[model samples]
Target: MTGSPAPVPDRATRIVVVGAGFAGFETVRRLLRHQRRSTDRPIRVTLISPDDFMLYTPLLPDVAGGLLDARFVAIPLAESLPGAELIAGRVDSVDFDGRTLQVRNREGAAETVEWERLVLTPGSVTRLFDIPGLAEHARGLKTATEALYLRDQMLEQIELAARETDPAVARARRTFVVVGASYAGTELTAQLRALADEAARHRGTVPDDVRFVLLDMADRVMPEVGEKLGDRVLEVLRGRGIDVRLGTTIDRLTAEAAELSDGTTIATRTVTWAAGVTASPLIQELGLPTEKGRLIVGADLSVPGDPDVFAAGDAAAVPDLAQRSGKGADDAITPPTAQHAVRQGKVVARNVIASIGVGTRKDYKHNDLGLVVDLGPRFAVANPVGVHLSGYPAKLVTRAYHLLALPRGANRMAVSAAYLGDAVFPRPLVSFGLVSADEASFPRSQGIPAPDSD
Candidate 1:
């Protein structure tokens, strides 16, 4: 007599991606595209993230300054990735050895997912240092909610100032302080100043009276962009009456003002901390090798000693092939910028497909394409393909580039219409009164109230 063995259930190869930023979104999209054309076997693709939309971070400043609507920049993930399973939750912990993940939804319900391949693109969060009172007072520019909160805060301050007759209180309401002169800080500073200037025209105070201070620890503003472009940006900002403080840091932050390391204190009601970003704590929990908080990955974007795991974007410390001496030289690392993240996402997708025997894996190698800083209409600085362009022409190039880079056609059209409308008509100077103290602070996720609940 022969005994029958148990029948094994059929299962599709499951691919799970975490964090729906530029990197994770791209990876899922590419894999689904590949799976769509394949006729051999079934492949399952799932994206797990806290938010249901993929934010277009480049245009966030515009939304904060009321140049573009918030809806224009946030693309619905479900619609964007039609065929993939979208898990609306934050990953609590990952079991790499078991190929499983523990995720918790907004309602505190938890679930576990098992996958054949895993991609980690949990983007970095606002970098908080040991500075006193910073986490309590300053706001970040990472998400659409933060940007909208900032916009409402700015407008509310202006409106409150309009009702006050006291010179000191009015001045405090009109003043705005932003730290970090890099891409986010610099761009936000410029846009906010423009917003204040326009709104001031409709109020009692003149544009020149509105105070804006842009501070940075680096000697020159936007040094990463290029020396020439930095100088031009500095000039434009200065010409707009923005107090650009180079080689400075915030000594202390208060509800009413910011104390600079240079012993100068600026009285202001608004403080924005775009200083920098650090990798999310989720990466550290994995106990993987990391450089400056970013998980280390190889040339193929695969995590060391874990062939099935891969990482990219701000969460991964990818070696810069262009900056390195040769194959083994791992001294230089690629910057955690949107440009690199987008390309890394593509490479990781290709390699992930190759891992499942669909194609061949390729190493990630890309040169810096250049940088563009939009300082509102008729004012921008760009070094596209190593050619310097500034002022109006630069603005046009910058807008065109954004339109091309935006993920959705609807978003691109909305942004374009907003740009045109901005040129023709003035933006409304009003606040929605939606932002609260908890929603407008650094390190907000831990105990702060959710935006919708509040």
Candidate 2:
């Protein structure tokens, strides 16, 4: 007879959340809070991400423009998410039938972890196109590192342009092209224009030589805020000497120039591609039904057939109950925005807890709280709760919204301090020299493989 049978494994329920963006971070935080209040069952919360900090991505343009410190936007997960196991890794694949995940840690080791419940919030990445030389030369503004690199790159280009004996070379270096005129692209263009102006002054060069070109295929700038406010934003940008081009985009980009769709080519050394974002590549690897590259989930933010699997944020196509019209339910899906992601995180957390027999599940439904666009100093556009405001009032509302939206107390304080310092002192123009060109490339920083890669 055998001496003993195999020992039974721990029966505690395990919940694994992937990605630490707004949705995943909020989901983990809310779940941990619930675990502390309830003592009926044992629950293990695990968060798997490549980085240990959750990035407040809305402030990335500010960081890129040197208005805020990069460190202030990154919230340490270990400190913020207490009572949860933090695994530093990226999920490579998911075996939905087996209820397990294949993850590769920072050290390049692969590991398999089983989960009782799974939450997918691996947020979106820069939406790349098949345009030639795009992945090779274009830079993204998604992560903190990318933002810092952009700041340094802008400064470096300005410095180089100031000293070069060749006028053509200087002009090319001073010219900046920004694609996509939505929130990220618009904010980035405004902030960068200010930085370039200040840097040009410090370098003893003509600020007018430093040109910014903003391009978007849409007919208006920031149409999300409606026509009235959008028109105001366009006027502000034009007043700042930014060449805002509507109904136009880059057809091709090279190290020296960008060819526009309108059959015009401009000399430029830096091209910032803030075009758009699509769901993470991992979402498509599962062979699940997707809508516009995002995993399709029901109104309750749960997969149709898989009850234990939940999804939210940019990775999931969630139904917008608030906007449901007489047309059809499929016609109104939530737009992928940080506001929606944060709210969806809270709803997903409650539904997950309900699945574990703690409470009843509820559907996710929220109306628009309005939009805010910060266009450099003393200039902004906002429609708070359907009230349009521009200029100084809008600026105040925009800043207040950001400060209040930031989760951590320390981060908010640090950001506020940075803003105060910016008012009193000149913006810093020195490059840190920490991130290299290779290190900041799209393939290296954002983890998006090249087009030719298998």
- lDDT for 186 in candidate 2 is 95
- Score residue 421 of candidate 2 by CA lDDT: 87
- Candidate 1 TM-score versus the reference: 0.94
State the lDDT of candidate 2 residue by residue for 1-454, as single tens digits. 0012112225657888999999999999899887677667657788888898999998999999999988899999888888887888889999988889999976789989889999999999999998888889889999888888889988988888878999998889989899999999999999998888888778777778889999999999898899998998999899888999999988898889999999999999899999899999889888899999999999999999998899999999998888895344656888889999999999999999889988899999988788888888779898988999999999899999999999999999999998888888878886896887677788778778767896
lDDT of each: 0.85, 0.88
- Give the clashing residue pairs of candidate 1, or none: none
Candidate 2 lDDT (Cα, 0 to 1): 0.88
lDDT of 1 at 312: 96
For model 1, what is the C-alpha lDDT against the true structure? 0.85
Residue-pair clashes per prediction, in order, are 0, 0
